[model samples]
Target: MSAAKPTIAVVDYGMGNLRSVTKALEHVADGRAHITLTAQPEVVRAADKVVFPGQGAMKDCMAGLLESGLKDAVLEAAANKPFFGVCVGAQLLLDHSEEGDTPALGLYAGQVKRFPDGLSDAAGARLKVPHMGWNEVWQTARHPLFAGVADGSRFYFVHSYYMAPADAALSLGYAEYPFAFSAVIGRDNVFATQFHPEKSAAAGLKLLENFIAWDGQR
Candidate 1:
């Protein structure tokens, strides 16, 4: 008899791009694991791994978590199992977000900060807000989830606020938008990315592939 496959939960709190995140996971999972898009806390807590994804305003995201009663589940999963956060999901893992003076899950000690105005690149050209499009993510340390992914590889990004962990040692990856910003943050079983790996191409797929195989170790 074969062993039962691991269960990977994609948390749905009515804010994230669920279909894209789910599809991406399914693509990489390829029957190695069972991927579920769920709002039920019981299902989430019972899963072997959890993927928390979000987008749009921080206020709405928090409100949705409360409305759906999945906030505690997320916290529990992050504390006890492998957790992967994407975009606003990554931001929510921190203590707070300036996006609406909103409080978050506090999974990590940090703040989500907005990009300052009057920004300019090296050529002195004005940079846009939201920082849309693809950007290279530079690895800060060797990690299991980062396995097989090259340093300085580009990933898709579309956000104004960036993650700023209180402990600089928690910073695992960085990307520049005129200046350096936190693109990935993690410790132990929790890992997060500000960019959308599902929307990114080959590099993104590789990252997802790595996550499926990761054992949540340092």
Candidate 2:
């Protein structure tokens, strides 16, 4: 008998850019899995895998999750299933964010911080606050998610604040924005990225494929 198809839930808490995230997952699923964009708490609880993708302010995102009653569902998935977080979804896993001084889900250790004011690159040219465009992401640890991704493969990025995990051991990848910052992180059944793998083209797709196949044991 064929194995049951895994249901991957893309949580819809009303804050993130969900269209691209949902479409990207669908494309990568390729009949190997079922992807659902759900706002219902029960549906999230039942899924085999969860993709928590978010875009915009940390305060609003947390508010939406709380009002929708999806926070607990997300916490349950993180503790018990193959969970993936993208962008702000990744940030929410941390203890808190400096953005509006928002409190996070506290799933991951450490705090989210904004890029310091008066920052400049090596050339002394002021770096943009919202770090945009494509940048090289260096794999810092071994995990199934980066099976085919090269060590210094470039990925798409769009964020201003970054998460600074208290434990460096949680980091899986780092990218340099004229300096080093974490780009990927994983712990137990959970994995997350500051860069959008969906927007990352070939390398990103490979990572998604790996996630789809991963059994979450690691």
Best by TM-score: 1
Q: How high a TM-score does candidate 1 get?
A: 0.97
The top-ranked prediction according to lDDT is 1
Overall local distance difference test of candidate 2: 0.90
> Against the hidden reference, what TM-scores do the models get?
0.97, 0.96
Q: After superposition, how far is residue 8 of candidate 1 from its true place, in Å?
A: 0.3
Backbone clash pairs in model 1 (N, Cα, C under 3 Å; residues 3+ apart or in different chains), count = 0
- In angstroms, give how far residue 161 of model 1 lies from its true place: 0.3
Q: For residues 82-198, could you state the per-residue lDDT of candidate 2 as single tens digits?
A: 999999999999999999999999997888888777878888998887999899988888888889889999899999999799999998999877678889988988999999989
Q: Model 1 Cα RMSD, Å?
A: 1.6
Q: After superposition, how far is residue 1 of candidate 1 from its true place, in Å?
A: 17
